[model samples]
Target: MQRGYFFSAEGGEGAGKSSIVSRLSEYLDSRGLEIITSREPGGIAIAEQIRSVILDKENTEMDGRTEALLYAAARRQHYVEKIVPTLNEGKSIICDRFIDSSLAYQGHARGLGIDKVLSINEFAIEDVFPDLTIYLDIDPEVGLRRINENADREINRLDLESLAFHRKVREGYLELVRRFPARIVKINANQKMDEVFEDVKQVFDRFLVSMGKLS
Candidate 1:
């Protein structure tokens, strides 16, 4: 029934989406809001298994269309098992990534075609798009540099892609802004992490205001 709002955060690697989502969920909790924070490709058990297959560096022979399909399969499980039920139960959700990642990574960067990837995702998400999508915009080089500094970070198949592919991912996001201008908000993430989160807060505050959750 979606008694509360859904917020999805989008960005390239090292854009600090996980940290931002955690902080926002904590803030909402402090404000007496029931907020659930999650991430895509593996939010629950079934989806986590699918995520592993998609991210495995050993799966170098995986086809582009296969990768996209795996993502869609995981997404559908996550939504049905976690997201939809949480929203229906009247809890707000903040997802670290969503269909937008596929549109950028598999669709555009992998040369699978944005429209093709989007069409595949449509069957899973079923038009229940995020009420708000906050995109953290940073140059691909800068973002990749940050990723390189994190040794503890899990190295996925996508992380091993050439810098050129990541740049295309960024371009794909920009194209998405043009496609869904009203729903996607761009934020400069080149600054300090705290600065980025402050911008996230402001954007979320506006959404809450619009929904009459704030005065």
Candidate 2:
């Protein structure tokens, strides 16, 4: 039986992660690959409820460690209920975010330390990490500006963070790239949508070829 692969996309707020994931999933599907798309902290019913609590604007009093724990809990459930079953059936999945977000947000930006947060997730996910992670590189300022201009986007607790906090988040993501060079690929998201999509496509095609999923 063929094995299913996992793919994840990570970026700071307003980095167009949703759009990129959608396009990438569509691209993969067109190539006759069976694929599914989901998001961390909110894929299944239980996880979605946890997502509401984590992102609620009223949860301003939540502590950094508490936030990290919540994310891990949600991830645990999502992985067990959704990810494992899908992969077992030999269907690839494209997740909007994954363990990287917790590592960057709660671990680095929230000052909990990446290793500490990673340890928590290590138990939550039981070592099932993504096969490939696409990191969308962008200027935090530009990303925030895009968020402000987009009225349709939901305003979450994380989005209310100060510019400095968001910049730290970006730094955390960069650090992750440095540490996990083999599993993560960085794509410039500061360009136009078409340009960003093309870059992501190139990286994705390369990944497929490397995995022997494509010639």
TM-score of 1: 0.97
Model 2: worst 10 consecutive residues (lDDT sum):
204-213
TM-score of each: 0.97, 0.98
lDDT (10s digit) by residue, model 1, range 84-147: 9899999989898999999999998899999999999999988789989999998989988988
Local lDDT at 43 for model 2: 95
Candidate 1 residues lying further than 4 Å off, grouped into runs, are none
Worst 10 residues of 1 by lDDT: 1-10
Q: For candidate 1, what is the lDDT?
A: 0.90
User: lDDT of model 2 at residue 143?
Assistant: 95
Clashing pairs in 2: none
